[model samples]
Target: MFAFASLLALAASAAALQVTQPSNSSGWTTSGPNTVTWSSVSTDNSNFSIVLNNQNTYPQYNEVLEALIQTSEGSVAVNPPSGGWVAGTGYRVNFVKNSQDLSSLLAQSDDFTIEQSSSSTFSAVPLLRPARPRPLVPCQSPQPAPPPLRRLARESASNTDSSAGSSASSASGSSSSTNAAPGLNVQTGVYGLLALLGIALA
Candidate 1:
């Protein structure tokens, strides 16, 4: 019975105690299913849990961000609290057999990095609007077109000829009667008959 008890104690001491993931170069985001892996010498039935800690709060393990799982799976995915981590380095992963007891630490990984997720770190940007167009000016009324040069020249020549004919008719009245003889001037014929009768009587 003593030998059996000693063997059991040794086996229990050798159970899940070595962390294999979240190495020194690992970069885990606060909002992700970051993989946490470890080794266990015990049977597959042994349960384990994970915790996130900051390297600045080292030996005390006070700054602990608890994961949302406790299972027997040696390798599992754990997401840190959305509001837990800031963007920086020097983060560590802690493996524990019981989440309620930090004293039951099973394994500890090297210092890794935790950062703010892209979704949470984003901010809203303002949109750009197009400029307004200027108002148009009103148009003025059109002017009337001038008379054509060809028509003006024809009217000027007709007026000149009419004026010259009127001045010549006023300068010579008897010549004007002779010029009207084609239509038989009655004044000229009467004056000629009276002069012939006077010549006969004398």
Candidate 2:
């Protein structure tokens, strides 16, 4: 009975060890454009360092822009320490371009996926939280409005006619000015004669 009890205790401890094994292996899949989901064999106790495997394809020099952890509970954004991944949880890391001007990245797509190095370790991945819906307000009824046909037609026709007339007038003005070249040539000749006389006197 003592030997049996000792064997049972050893078996229980081994089972516990297996259950508590650290997730050192990592895997990834593209969720959508600009989003990726990373799954680990185990949860992370310390901050995980994820490097972009294909930086050459992305606009940013790095493929690992950020890491996101999603679990049964909720999701969190992981970046630099103040914005890094939460320790002791499974996470989905997303790589994206860093945009300083826009509120969000212009393009979002995982160029390529990366796996955790054999030396790396982590815990279980956390679940993402659902976003709260916005409250709806009662909309006011609209008043009756006049028909827009006349107003729209008048505005459009007037703009078109004015533009056509302006263009025609400009063309005519250009032609008339171009036709007055002989007068300009006479002026040029007079100026040339005066210049020659001045030069002779000098």
In lDDT terms, which candidate is top? 1
User: In candidate 2, what are the lDDT values of residues 113-154, reduced to their tens digit?
Assistant: 333334323455898889899899899899889669999899
Which ten contiguous residues of candidate 1 have the minimum total lDDT? Answer: 60-69
* Model 1 alpha-carbon drift over 4 Å, by segment: 1-16, 43-45, 57-72, 82-84, 116-202
Q: What is the lDDT of every predicted structure here? A: 0.70, 0.43
Q: Estimate each model's TM-score.
A: 0.43, 0.26
Go through the candidates in order and give the C-alpha RMSD of each one to the true structure. 14.5, 30.1
Q: Which consecutive 10 residues in model 2 have the weakest lDDT in total?
A: 15-24
- Model 2's lDDT to the true fold? 0.43
Residue 145 in model 2: lDDT? 90
